[model samples]
Target: MVIVGSTNPAKLEPVRRVFAEVFGGLEVRGVEVPSGVRVQPIGYEETFTGAHNRAKGALRTPGASWGLGLEAGVEFNDLGAWLFNVAVVLREDGRTGVARGGSVLLPPAVGERVRAGEELGPVMDELVGQKDTKKGPGAVGILTLARVERVEFWRHTLELALPPFLRPELYPLE
Candidate 1:
């Protein structure tokens, strides 16, 4: 398994867990990859694009069997606050499968404040009735209180999702 992007421990550890649990016998490794595009706190389209771009790049590397990309960012729905979403994309045999994960919703008022350019932390502090250091840890950060790191979350999502995409013959008729 090739994890496309940074080798930061927080990012890599989750990627490893997904490989171990899902693929069972495959080698899991992390390598820094270039997306050729960077957007701070990525949004939906960019996040997916970034992930796809990374997977393509990782595959070009010598000796790679599979490539994974995890990209997370904030996006606004009709409610208008910056909500969190993560994109996980995998490439093997020149084919790709992608899944997106996110928190259901953030407090609506908080989004309005974020739209005015305040950071998510300050807004979350008010919305959750907490104060200080609220949004500082992990991807899907405040939504999950830093538990299960985003990297791992994305990896697990992709890992569990693959069998269905690859082995549809096993599924019962709809």
Candidate 2:
């Protein structure tokens, strides 16, 4: 069984698809667990920490074979603030795999809002005049105009994270 940290369908569906593809017939569940970080993690350290914490928290649940955590946040580089996604998976034996998805520069307006303490989901929802877009296409889909959906972003991250889990000999459980 796999336990995902967030109950948000956006975070859960991709994992379900990826888990089924790699580990057939496994049961997957999304549990609303705390990330133990800011509601809007601003940079890589906090975002990655949130993902790691969620994975550890999910592992606490009885019968959980694996814990999955997904986090999206923005990092400011010389050019601008770019949004990125991170996926972390933790197995029962304490093995972990992590991967990052593609990142897109947030428009100046959106970055300003995010820097000023607005959550990306609400910011995107307001800009696009849509309700709960985060649960659907999300900021990546909206920013990319559906070229890539949020689930797709997670899908790519999952694909990157799965290799180590799939090839335990190569990864060596270190």
Query: Which candidate number has the best TM-score?
Result: 2
Candidate 1 local lDDT, 1-174, one digit each (tens): 565555546556666676676666766666777755554344678767776777776666676777766665567767654555444445555555667764545556665665566666555666666665332344255567767455655665566446644675674334
TM-score of each: 0.67, 0.97
Clashing pairs in 2: none
lDDT of 1 at 75: 72
How does candidate 2 score on lDDT? 0.89
| TM value for model 1 | 0.67
- In angstroms, give how far residue 161 of model 2 lies from its true place: 1.0
lDDT string, candidate 2, 1-174, tens digits: 899999999999999999888889999998878998888898889999999889888888889999999999888867877899888999999889998888999999898888888888899899989999989999889988899988999999889988788888898864
Q: Where does candidate 1 stray beyond 4 Å?
A: 104-136, 147-152, 164-174
